[model samples]
Target: MDIIVEGIKQAFILLFTLDREVLGITWLSLKISGSATFLSMFIGVSVGTAVALNQFPGRRFVVSLINTGMGLPPVVVGLFVTIFLWRNGPFGFLEMLYTPTAIVIAQTVIATPIVMGISLAAIQSLPANLRLQILALGATRLQMVWILVKEARLPLLAAVMAGFGGVISEVGASMMVGGNIKGYSRVLTTATVMETGKGNFAIAMALSIILLLLAFTVNVVLTQIQQRDRPR
Candidate 1:
């Protein structure tokens, strides 16, 4: 109990003091996760909507695969990403291992399916005749898709939240791909893990607190946008 309280106090101190290391880690975390979520949103929404609207062979199988990917284990993702980025591995000529960019790639892999699955469901949940209605009104297919996406904005926003949440809180993939290099690739989750491993319980707890607060702040802003203009 005392430890927990002390940790909270330390977290505030770190925040109030504008600790450079903590702030840098926090910013990098947001930047990487934000970029990952944005990329996932672009790819996931496009592919998910296409799949939702079209009738094709093996469509069910593809959807099942996407659903499976939503729950893909982070450590497993980390392992494959690490392997692919290894010095002698394919595409290793770019030499991206143990870097922030590598972390972003792993996180993008982690978040894309989550966003894709939710986007697929959101587009599918609309009234069956909605797409036809839009097309019947002289809207082109592209315009119809745009309208449908607009209609599904609320749930799509939720997908953003989920994707960002997943990547921001994950440590395994970041640690594996980033090597948790201080002042470069270090982030709250990896830092917390490192501190705990070194028995710096107070520092670990403080980092954890900061991470939770960061997640909460981002979600709060997103939630506000989501709820705004919602029907009373």
Candidate 2:
């Protein structure tokens, strides 16, 4: 307990001192996770809309796959991206290994499932009457989808928040694909681990604190949005 308290004290000092390494890691984490979340939102929303509105063979199976993907282990995602980007892998010629792009790819893989699954739930939760009413009004398929999506905006926003939280806090994928390279691909979570291994508890604690604050801020904002959009 004493050790932990001491670490916290030193971490605050580092924060106030404007430690360069700490700032660098925080910036990289935000940059990579933000990019990954943006990409995931694009793909996930498109696929989720298609799956929700279209009835076809194996639709249930596809949604089941997405649900399973929501719980996918970050380490597994890391391994998958690593192999695909490795020197002997299919896209090895692109030489994307150990880069910020690789980290973004890994994070995207992890986040997409969350976004897709959440979107599915949101779309499915809408009232059947509402859907039927829209159809009765002779709305086009695209118009119907947009209406449903707008009605479920709160849930979709929650999905985005969940994906952002997952990607921002994940260390395994970031470390594996980004190589935790100093001043390069290093992020807050990966940097915390690296600093701890080097016996730098102060910086590690500081990074952890910053990460927690970011996660809290995201959740708070999402909750506000959800409340504002809640059906009265």
Candidate 3:
């Protein structure tokens, strides 16, 4: 009880004073997660839409794989990513291990499937004849895809929220790939974990509160846009 109250008070103090370490970790969290979510959005939306609109061999199998991937464990993702980025691994020449960029890659892998699965469902839910109608209206294949994407914007926004939410709150991959070095790759989730492990519950709680605030702020903005664009 006392600890919880103290933690909340500490959180406000950190925010109000703009503590350098706290601010840096907060910003880095946003940067890594934001970059991951953006990349996931692009790749996920494109591939999911392609898969949803096209019929080819093994399509069902591919979608099943994607749906499975949406629930991939963060620790498993961390293990594979760490192995791939380790010295002497396939892409080891790039030397990206234990860096913020590595965290972004791991997070992207974590978030992409989530966004893709949601987007696949969103696009597939639209009217079946919508594509044909767009083409009959003299729209090119590219334009048709764009219009369909626009029509599914609402649910797509949900995809963004889900993707961002997944990656931003994930710590296992971030810790494994980032090394949690202070002022370098340390992020809110990893920082909280470190603080907690050291019995710094107050600090941990403060970081957790800040993380919730950050996630809430981003979701709020996205929700506002989503509601504003809702169809009457």
Candidate 4:
């Protein structure tokens, strides 16, 4: 349709000209999502590995919780985060509501379970005897964990992609926590939503295209690394 064509053209123009607003939103989007994904990687990988390798009481319950968390609704996450950050709420003294940092927190909550769940599955998929093999070779517990993690690097990278994909594409939590203030917390997803609400379909489409392109570029790089590391 004419709208799709026009939107594509607008997207091209925005990228080619590096429109300040567009560029700023794009960069902020990356920053917030990237930060969230990175933080999630650390927390998710650690917790997942710990849970996978240990046999604690109520382990299944914990795993069930993590699995449930992976599918949590973004709006629910945003609402809780907002409430916690609101004045007179717990930890309200930090005053992070409606800020980019708040967005990061909400996004981290959204992405953490995704990454953790995938990581749990990845580590669990490893050879059961592998841990014993390493220990038989006199590897320390710490070194054994590190080696296991390295062996599972491929799927762990996939977790990164999934986590980044989840957070970057999510709009609800970002809108609620970010407030979408121009040049401040406005991101690609929120900007697109605002434009769409205002009937600027072309602009909204353009932003959507840009977001897809961005996600694609990052995934391409990750995919290349993943393929390169594949076992012959």
lDDT of 1 by residue, 7-79 (tens): 7788778778988888898899999999999999999999999999999999999999999999988989999
Error of 1 at 42 (Å): 0.5
Per lDDT, the best of the predicted structures is 3
Residue pairs clashing in model 2 are none
Please provide TM-scores, in order, for all candidate models, with all chains considered together. 0.96, 0.94, 0.97, 0.96
lDDT of each: 0.92, 0.90, 0.95, 0.93
Off by over 4 Å in 3: none
lDDT score, residue 28, model 2?
A: 81
Off by over 4 Å in 2: 228-232
Residue 203 error for model 1, in Å? 1.9
Candidate 1 vs 2: which has more lDDT: 1
- RMSD in angstroms, all models? 1.2, 1.6, 1.1, 1.2
**Tens digits of per-residue lDDT for model 4, 77-195:** 99999989988899799999889999999999999999999999999999999999999999999999999999999999999899999999999999998899999999999999999
Q: How many residue pairs clash in each candidate?
A: 0, 0, 0, 0
Show the lowest summed lDDT stretch of 10 residues, model 2: 223-232
The worst-scoring run of ten residues by lDDT in candidate 4 lies at 6-15
